[model samples]
Target: MSEQLPAPDPARFPALDADPSWVLSVPEGTLIARIFRAGGTHPVAWHEFRTFGPLDGRFDPHPLPVGEHEGAGVLYGVLERGRGGGVADGGALGGAFAAALLEVFQAQRMIRLRDGSPTLAAFEVTRPLRLLDLSDSDWIAVAGGNSAISSGDRERSRVWARAIAQRYPELDGVVSASSLVPDARVVALWAGAADALPRYPAALLPLGRDELIGVIDRIADRYGYLVL
Candidate 1:
């Protein structure tokens, strides 16, 4: 039988309380937990520090069971920030977060496959200030749809949207980097600006129609605004 993990220490790793803040670290992993103002009946909100990688890889996705909760459909992403460009810094955190996200996806059974593979894309989270500042932002940017688009892939996008909708219900909408700059800007404006979108802009928007569609395909849960 698999060994049961050790029980967490309340003194060291306290149970999340109202507006609780704590740090957790495993050998190669670290988690920063913060409790935010509860959105619904639940007394607390949680944000974790983790990373993600492709499903073919060793890591398993985290568990996030879908429920009739208020914040069930919000999708989460990492926002990396730092002077160095190595995985050890913010990159590692992004991977860890992705891994956790996968677990949640698995728990919710939201995985969708197109060619016998998990329809998920891994991204490195970054930010203009500290990577930790991600929790404070109203929006996040999800990059790397260009490659998926070039290959005409939809598996990754479908699964991502389903998972996000299943998990964070509070998410208002999604903004794709692939949308025409002017068009995306208009949607952003309609949504009350970038902060109103679920994710923000960090990297250069992907070029070409295929790449743009690829980004949108991965995030199919949101309304698509056509530039033309």
Candidate 2:
């Protein structure tokens, strides 16, 4: 049987009332975007710090993505902006979603262990990853018929619309990212404008989209956060 993991300590993120349910080491290139894929909910295999991203040929005991490796616990931080009225759009779901949640965990000052290490020294997660059923439709809505557009099936977008409506009736008529994640208590923590939205010109952006040193200007104007 797999070992039962320990849980996070409350003192890490004071803003959080309880310790994180899962402590994860995030890979590089995870962006907090507004992904609205239509269809069935996506499943993410819980990650191990070592297996979180890629191997650095194992010679150095660290991974190739040395720069982006960071650690964090999960939380249901309130979704501030959904799809409109100047709020940041809902964050992307799936692997990106899980990584986005990690951003909040890394924000804490106490356990800043993401200093380019290949493997996390130790960690804990309260719940069984098997129990986690994460879905993009659960927290985000489509921005347009093309929100979930796919080249695979020309009618895939229509099918997804019907499915989304049938699966999540409440999200019907939701056309913007803001409208989708209303009152969404996402796995997140408090952050400055960096995590909020870009406020300056893209050319002036140093990292362009690194949540740690980046910002989204006037959240309402745009919401997609996926790097690619």
Per-residue CA lDDT of candidate 1, range 41-106, in tens?
432222211222222211112223422332222333322222233222324333332333233233
Q: Per-residue CA lDDT of candidate 2, range 1-228, in tens?
A: 422212222222121112232122222222232211112343221121222322211111112343433331111222222222211232322222322223323324122223221111101222122111122332211122322232122133333333333333221121212113323323221111122222321111112234422222223123433321
Compare the candidates by lDDT and give the number of the best one: 1
List candidate 2 stretches off by more than 4 Å: 1-81, 85-107, 110-228
TM-score (C-alpha) between model 2 and the true structure: 0.17
Q: What is the TM-score of each predicted model, taking all chains together?
A: 0.22, 0.17
Candidate 2 — worst ten consecutive residues by lDDT sum? 117-126
